[model samples]
Target: MTVTIGFVGAGGIAEWQHFDIVEARDDVEVAGICDVNQAAASEAAERFDATAYTDHEKLYDGEDLDAVFVCIPPFAHGPAEIAAAERGIDLFVEKPLALSVDRAREIHQAIDAADVLAGVGYDWRYSRGVERAQELLDGRTVATIEGRWWGGVPGDDGHWWREFEKSGGQIVEQATHVYDTVRLLAGDVEAVSGAGSHRLVDAVDFADSTSVTMEHESGAISHVSTTCAAEDHDAHLEVVADGATLRITEEEITGTVDGEDIEESFDVNPYAVEVDAFVEAVAAGDPSPIRSTYDDAFDTFALTMAANEALDADGRVQPAAIDDGTDAGEADQ
Candidate 1:
């Protein structure tokens, strides 16, 4: 069965990752493309032979979509997501769910009430290397978890990401992949403490270099550091467990398990894997195949937001609590 898909944003990661992946799949049809930029939306629409619209509401109203990929920036998140959820359309959202925690919470509530299947773009969770790291660390005590995303300032779609208010800084905006992968390998973070410096980037007041320490609920300690100062790009997560030490990067997993050396290279494309997973789940009428569901990714958002708070306060901050909406509704009743 062909899963009909709509795109909420048509540039940068949307085109580079999602557009190409879905367009290559025979069982997936690109039904509509919507972006604030008319030229971008129209170009993508023309290429895919899909309809183009400037507003997501119009796309949602006009097209019979099985799922919509909400790829807008962090600040432009709420409206598209809420509208889609209200219409009972499944969603695949790109991460750092929103610039504000309250906005993310609201979107989460909408998805829950509508009973829609939603996936977040924490594509690293689907990496073969990450899976290998999980297998190696299973049934073992994880001691220290370390992750890093060292890279240059991103300028893909536009300069919107360079602004703090729009992008939520480097930790929340770009390195969130590291944070999500850390949570996947270690556990949910109970508290976040971090420090950052904005001396490097003049364009934004937020940090250009950041280091976050996360205390997992399981009593494990994890540290993730990010910097947009370097010219080279590197991202990876390393975990030290009872009997194994595993390092997972986008391309491979390498380290020692049971005092034996191990190395595994992955040729897999995580973007394709994640997209395929979402499409399959949409077709199967089950979201279990998606590794990063909306609520699950929200936890990662809360963690990063806590890190942001920690940076400003110079103290540990617990992640903002989120309810599944069941108890809150009953309380109101």
Candidate 2:
């Protein structure tokens, strides 16, 4: 089946993840491209041989697309998702689904009410090593999960990513992958406390470096840190589940346990496997493991937001739940 696809943003993600997977797949087709800038849309449309539009509504309304990928910045997400879900279009929205918890829940309701297949692009959840680690760590008592994502901050390159309202600082903009992956390995975060600073980057007003401690309802302790200060970019996710430790460093994983030395060294390319999974889910009507379901993504996003809140005030933020009402507790069973 040919799955028609529309996109709300045609910047980095479109050039990278969306184009690579959607265009490569025999079952997927690029139906329309939308961007606030006509030039960008046109360039992407020509490159992909798809139609482009300056306004998202035209792309959304004119085409009978199967799914829409909302790769717009965080601030643009709420409006984009509202339109897609209302149209009953299956959606593949990128991570940090929204800048705030309230907007996240609103999108959740719209998608659920529309009875659409909705998923968020928490891309790291699709990594091969990440999947292996989750299997090893599942049904085990996880002790600690530590992660660090450091790189030079993205400057204003005519993108909304430079704006705080759009990106929510580096924490929400970039570190959300680490945040979401930690939750996937550990569990739902309960309490958050920490500190952050704007000592490095001149682009954003808020902190470009943040460190936080989270206590999960599973009693697993996690240490999360992110910064745009390092000279070279790096990513790492390490989980200590009981006596076993599974780690993936800035570029790869090393070490072994139980005769399985699961290691995969790789370049940090922008393309992702999660996009394929989302598209496949749209085709098959079956949900993927890391669907970034409304509740799951919001919990991680709220935890990240609350971590920032606690850091700014030097206090503990508790009951990290969803509902756009600041009711930070676990989701309903």
Candidate 3:
């Protein structure tokens, strides 16, 4: 059966990852494209032989879609996912989930009530290196975890990412991959304390240098650092297990595991793999192929949110203690 799909955001990620991956598959068809920018929507629609709309409601009304990709920005997450779930259309949402934890929880509840298949774009989870790392660390006891996301500012000086309100700072908007990967490697975090500085980047209001210390429920300690003042981009997650150290970068995983030397590299595109998984799950009428569902992604978002809260209170904050007016503690449960 051909899976008819619609795109709710025709921006960079939609074109580069979701659109290209789905276009390559003969079992799927791009039915419609939506963007607040009419030109972008029209251009993407013409390129993919689909219809374009500036409003997502119209796209949903006009198309017979099995699923839709919610590729909007960090702050623009709620309405599209809720509307699609209400229509019983499956969702493939991009990361960060939302700017607020309460909003993300509502979206999660909506999807659960609708009982539709959902996937989040935590694409790093789909990498071959991650698969191997899980295999190698299957039953091992983890010690200290180190995660880093050091990079220069993204987009232009006036880009939305520069604004903390819009992007949720560097940790939430970009380094979430590092946070999520570490959570996958080590267990859930029990408490978090963070410090941040905003001295370098004049246009950005948020912290340019941020460091977080997490106390894991597994009795393990984690230190995650991120900065937007660097000239080069460098990001990685390293897990120091008993007698083994495994490091995961975007292109490869290298280190010693199980008392043996190991170095594995992957040139594969995780974005394409994740999009393919979402499409395949939709086509097969199953959700098991998706590695990161909305609920799972919410845990990661909560962790970042806790870090932000920690920075605010200048004290250690439990992920469950966030002031989003909900039982955020249940997110980890």
Top lDDT hit: 1
lDDT, candidate 2, 1-333, per-residue tens: 888898888987777667877777888888889999899999889877899898877888999988998888788778788888898888888777887777888888898889888887776776665666766766778889998888886755645666777788778878888988888877888787788887877766677788988888888999889888789988888887765777864345665656667666666532456776777788887776335776678887887787767666545677456653774432321
Ranking by TM-score: 3, 1, 2
lDDT of 2: 0.78
Measured against the true structure, the TM-scores of the candidates, in listed sequence, are 0.95, 0.91, 0.95
Q: Give the TM-score of candidate 3.
A: 0.95
Q: Give each model's whole-structure lDDT.
A: 0.88, 0.78, 0.87
Q: Write candidate 1's Cα lDDT for 32-54 as tens digits.
A: 99999999999999989999999
Residue by residue across 172-281, what tens digits does model 3's lDDT show?
Answer: 99999999988998889888887888889887899999989988999989999999898899898888998789887767888997678888888888888888888889
Q: Which of the two, 1 or 2, has more TM-score? A: 1
Off by over 4 Å in 2: 157-159, 249-251, 258-272, 327-333
lDDT of 1 at 158: 51
Colliding pairs, model 2: 319-328, 321-328, 321-329
lDDT of 1 at 236: 87
Deviation (Å) of 146 in candidate 3: 0.2
lDDT of 3: 0.87
